[model samples]
Target: MSGPGTAAGAAGRAGQSDALEHLARVGLIAYGMVHVLVAWLALQLAWGGGSSESADQSGALATLAESPVGKPLLWVLAVGLVALALWQAAEVVRWRSGWSASGDTRKKAVEKTVKAVAKAVVYAALAVLAFRAATGGGQSGSGQQQQTTAGVLGWPGGRWLVAAAGLVVIGVGAHHVLKGLKKGFLEEIDLASAPPTAERTVTRLGQVGYPAKGVAFAVVGALLVYAALTFDPARASGLDGAMRTILDAPFGRVLLTLVALGIAAFGAFCFVRARYPERT
Candidate 1:
């Protein structure tokens, strides 16, 4: 028999993946850039993306990136970034409406070209991320995505896009929470603290991180945007900033640190999931 959440989960997966894949399909270069945008938003919302003390504390992030540790990580990130501009442009041309309608031999040639090029792109992206992993860089977002943002969209424009994307991310996460709740996926994560069962596995897997921080990112994004709009940057918070603020008391700092660590873990999980997005 089919599980209760299966249909909902499948539909959700399709919705998310198709949208992302379509972005890549449109123009791989643009796809690379979009992932970079979302990843920065994730960093801000989930990893303490911005600061209250400074209007655009992303400079602090840049400063952090310059540290011996940060410098090496950037090196790793940069190496992985592929300028997919020319490559992706060719792909768009090859796959344009007529690509599929070509004769069988031509179609086979097109398919071969797509696969070969796509594999190279994937390899290039992975190489950059692997450097991050080698340098002991922490996972806040997929390092592959990090590579793109760090190198491609530099400075004021990049920051602006990232900040806007933060708001979009928050909205997306909130939407996920609402959909999960309506479909009863939220209940799937409930713990029994007893013997394992098929239901428990499915429920726990669905519930663990998706509902909570998915929504948390959204909240952080909204607040940060509001703060930016109100001209009160002090009100702005990312995952790190918000949690730290909430736990301002003595032991609170410790709690927030743990939360930050947890976000890093969640990001790592996503990176891993990207390697096997279809597995779950």
Candidate 2:
């Protein structure tokens, strides 16, 4: 009879399947498309024109849903995202299984584990959202975020909890900014296979894209902190709210335009990543 070790070995092999890797790469394309749409929406908001679409991932997915082949595309995106999530899950398992044998320091192992876990959660959530959009049961992420904030605020010490959450988000944003500025993202890409021009293009896109995304997230975190302090959930709107807030500032148009372009660059970078991912 096959024992646990035999079953585990089989499972590990399955997780490393080439088919799954291909699907995950396709999922990266879907993710890039979402960012491109968000950039378009943000530009519209910056110009004081365009429909009432929210300038965030939900809005991007909604825009996709309204296209001629929206539902079909969403289904594909959903499947790809699921595959990506599973890939991350496999990475987490590998990290755990090889933690001691890998010869890496404890800190490095922990960091890799954390990053894999985070990616798994994010990809899984996006997959669910895509599936919901495909099924005509989609809801606004910003609205949901606000509602969750409101509910939390109603609990004892909820304000503190919200503030803590906001701080964590800010920290994440700062990390992204640092990663971009430091070219840390290149560590994950096998640029050795890319042509010189392609390498330059991808590097530039990541450098610009990371900071823009970081700025947006930082603004969102600030809004959450403001909402907690004021005891008002309306102030806790997500990316959409952040864009509007930027619009109200001096030289808002210029700033928003730059940020939108940066987001677009990031989206383009995703396409390159899909094609040139580092092999484990």
Candidate 3:
């Protein structure tokens, strides 16, 4: 009879499967494409006389939807993102099963577990969004965010909850900034076998990309906090709102242009990661 231990071992093996790894890589490519699209939308907002579409992931997917090959691409994205989520789920299982055997400090193990869980949730959510887009059921991400914020604010003590969530997002943004500045992302990828030029390109992309993304996230989080404080859900308009906020600042056009370029760099980095990921 197979026991819990046996089941865990099976899960671990399944997580390391070659097929899943390939799918996860494909998912990374799709992820990169989304970021590229977002960068394009951001540029439009910055200088192309403004865009009707939101400058966020949902907007990017929606752009894909308008293309002739949109449905097929969306289906591919949905499948790849689901696979990526499953791969992260498998990582969580592996971490749980080998928690004691890995000989790592308890803190490190916990951190790994948390990261895996977070990735799984993020990928799963993206997969759902892609699926919805493919099915013609996609909704505006900013609008959805506003509605959700409004609903949350209606609950007792929801203001505090929202504020706490904002703080968490800010922390995440700070981490990204630190990771970029400190080259901490190098620890996550293996480039020993990569050509010198390729390695340099990847490193440069990451250095520029992470901090830009961090800034964007920080703005979003700040907006969330502001919305909570003012009891205005409209302020919680997600990424697109964040971009617009930046555009409204002094010297906004230059800043937004730089940020858009950084985002494109990040998207390009994702393509390299798809080719040489140390972990799914």
Task: Using TM-score, give the best candidate's number.
Answer: 3
Q: Which 10 residues in a row give candidate 1 its minimum summed lDDT?
A: 52-61
Better of 1 and 3 by lDDT: 3
User: Mind sharing the TM-score for model 1?
Assistant: 0.36
What are the lDDT figures for the candidates, one per model? 0.43, 0.86, 0.87
Kindly list the per-residue Cα lDDT of model 1 for residues 50-116, writing each as its tens digit. Answer: 6322211232234345456766644434443343223333443444433445588667657645654
For residue 67, give model 2's deviation from the true position in Å. 0.6
Report residue 92 deviation for candidate 3 (angstroms). Answer: 0.9
For model 3 the local lDDT of residue 90 reads: 78
**lDDT per residue (tens digit) for residues 48-88 in model 3:** 75667799989989989999999999999889999989988
TM-score of 2: 0.93
lDDT of candidate model 1 versus the reference: 0.43
Q: How many backbone clashes does candidate 1 have?
A: 5
Model 3 reaches what TM-score against the true structure?
Answer: 0.95
Arranged by TM-score with the best first, the candidates are 3, 2, 1
Instruction: Estimate the TM-score of every prediction.
Output: 0.36, 0.93, 0.95
Name model 1 segments beyond 4 Å from true.
1-73, 79-169, 176-206, 225-230, 248-258, 277-280
